[model samples]
Target: MSAVLELTGFVLTLGGWVVIGATLKNSYWKVSTVHGSVITSSSLYENLWHSCAEDSIGISNCRAFDTLLALPAYIQACRALMITSLILGMCGTLLTLLGLKCTQLGSNSENAKSKIAMLGGMVFILAGLSSMVAISWYAERITAQFFDSFYGGTKYELGYALYLGWAGSLLSILGGIFLTCSACKEKHRDYKYAATRQGKDARIYIKQSETVTSAKDYV
Candidate 1:
């Protein structure tokens, strides 16, 4: 049962990471203004890496930025953070796989395996947090720019990509939490078993000592 829970968490986390990566690559973090509820040429959509425009005739075009140095500080930061999170997620997934009870990679002992699983869970949690911060930071900047009265008349609305990011972050967090719980439960069981063994050994030692004393008194 615990193994099932761990696997479920791991799969969910991986799914979340995939979604986040796809969303980041997608040029739909925000969509340009819609006119009369219809998307026109001015309906531009953008993501961390590129921007796209949709025309009234249903033509869509996209272009990646030619340069990164020219990008805004928030954009640069978002890109960096998201990339970092992806890296972390990759590493965490490997660790989780190795530590899984169903795997024998690090199964020298249940205790050691549990520790590895816990470590993987921690990495996954960090990956989730990094992605969350990046997405939230980018969203906040957008919100600020949109609501700013001094800002130009050009308007943009939150896009599907942002929603995907939110969903991905949530799933990653939940999955990591599940994995952590499983690790903790394993650790507790290990400790309990060790204690039981120690108690039994102590009882046997006492019995041996009592037998020795009786033998001496009889002699």
Candidate 2:
């Protein structure tokens, strides 16, 4: 049962990691709002790296951010966070694979494997949190600007990429929870078994001592 749970968690975490990658590559993190506009000739969309405009005829043009230093602090922060998340995810995946009971990569002891799995789960959770914060922060900024009555800038709405990021983050978090639980369960079982064996050994030693005492008395 623990093995199954571990495998399930691994799959979920891996899938979430892949989804996050897709989210990062996706271009539409935000799109220009069409609300209160009667005629829309073109649509503007942007991601962490670039902005794009699509005309009514479906022709689209894109331009990368000219300078990293000139970009908004939030954008730069988000980029860093997403990149960090990816790096952590990769490390977590490798650790998880090595720790899995079904794999032969790491130590043969279940205890060691369980510890590795737990560490991987923690890393996975951190990765998820990092991405979640980045995506939420970006969305919050967009929504704040959109609802501001005095704001003169173009209003943008949340796009598909944001949704993808949210989904991926959630999956990664859940997966991490499962992985942690499985590892804990295994560790608990091992401890229980060790305790039982120790108790049994003590009982056997007491019984042997009693027998020896009886033999000496009888002799």
Candidate 3:
């Protein structure tokens, strides 16, 4: 139950980061573009902002159309990532809860290395999730405004959007790394568990062999 809640939150977080990353990528693209640079200038922003609201905002307009096609895809990707991140987050939450709830917690052969891995993985998952939520929300708003600017007069707004997307990328990258780390933690934990179990079983077998050899000699 708690796992689901935590996971849901994590998913949103990762989703936000992914959105931020995508937005940043878009921003970088624009910055490099000939038109993007021109449109982003302060003077241009003042003249162009709110220009589209006064007209049909042209479906055929090349620049406008570019955003329409590209932004939707970006949004879609963000959504998909959001879903996946959340689900993983849920798994992490469940793992933590189960680890905590087990009666014979320490006796279950959870080795230190494995435990560390699991813990780290959970942390990363959380970080990733948080990033996703923050970035994604901003992305959605930016996309909407970009599309709504039909009057072709939104230089400042568009430029600002580009800048936000640019700045947000840092968060996106950091969050992504953290999320990935959390997964690694879980995987390492599994490896440790298996190794510990194997060691214990080996010790048992060795003792049994020794006991059998002694009995044969005594006979």
Candidate 4:
């Protein structure tokens, strides 16, 4: 049962990591709103790296951000967080693979493997949290600007990439939780087995001592 849970959790974590990568590559983190626009001939969309505009004729053009320092603080921070999440996910995945019961890369001791698995789970959770914060922060900014009555700038709406990021983050978190639980269960089972064995050993020793005492008295 624990093995099954661990495998399931690994799958979820890997899938989430892949999804996060896709989210990062996706172009539409935010799209310009058409609510108050008089001209509907063009639509603007943007991601962390670039901005794009699509015409009514379905032709689209894109331009990468020219300068990193000139970008908004939020954009820079989101980039950092997403990159960090990816790095952590990579590390977690490697550790989990090494720690899995089905694998032989790590120490033969179950205790050691369990510890490694738990550590991997923790890293996965951190990765998920980082991505979650970045996505949520960007979304919050978009919503805030959208609802501001005094703001005259072009209002934007949440894009599909944000949804993707949310989904990925959630999956990663759940996977991490499952992995952690499975490792704990295995550790507890080992502890119980050890305790039971120790108790049996004590019982056998006491019985042998009693038999020896009886024999000496009889002699």
TM-score against truth, every candidate: 0.91, 0.97, 0.38, 0.98
lDDT by residue for model 2 (100-209), tens: 99999989989999999999998999999999999999999999999999988789999999999999998888888889999999999999999999999999999999
- Please report how far candidate 3 places residue 179 from its true position, in Å: 1.6
lDDT tens digits, residues 1-219, model 1? 678888888988889889878877877888765633443545787888887877777788888888999999999999999998899889988988888888878677777878888888888888888899998998887778777878765667788888899889888888888889899988887789999999999999999999999999999
Total clashes in model 2, counting residue pairs 3 or more apart in sequence or in different chains: 0
For residues 115-142, write the lDDT of model 3, one tens digit per residue: 5334534544453554355445544555
**What 10-residue stretch in candidate 2 is worst by lDDT?**
33-42
Q: Rate residue 61 of model 2 by lDDT.
A: 97
Give the per-residue lDDT digits (tens) of candidate 4, residues 8-120.
99999998998898999999999999898898899999999999999999999999999999999999999999999999999999999988999999798899999999999
The list of candidate 2 runs beyond 4 A from truth reads none
Those runs of model 3 whose alpha carbons end farther than 4 Å from true positions after fitting are: 1-43, 46-158
Clashes of 4: 0
Q: What TM-score does structure 2 among the candidates reach?
A: 0.97
What overall lDDT goes with each candidate model?
Answer: 0.84, 0.94, 0.44, 0.94
Q: Count clashes in each candidate, considering only residues at least 3 apart in sequence or on different chains.
A: 0, 0, 40, 0
- Root-mean-square deviation of every model: 2.2, 0.9, 11.2, 0.9
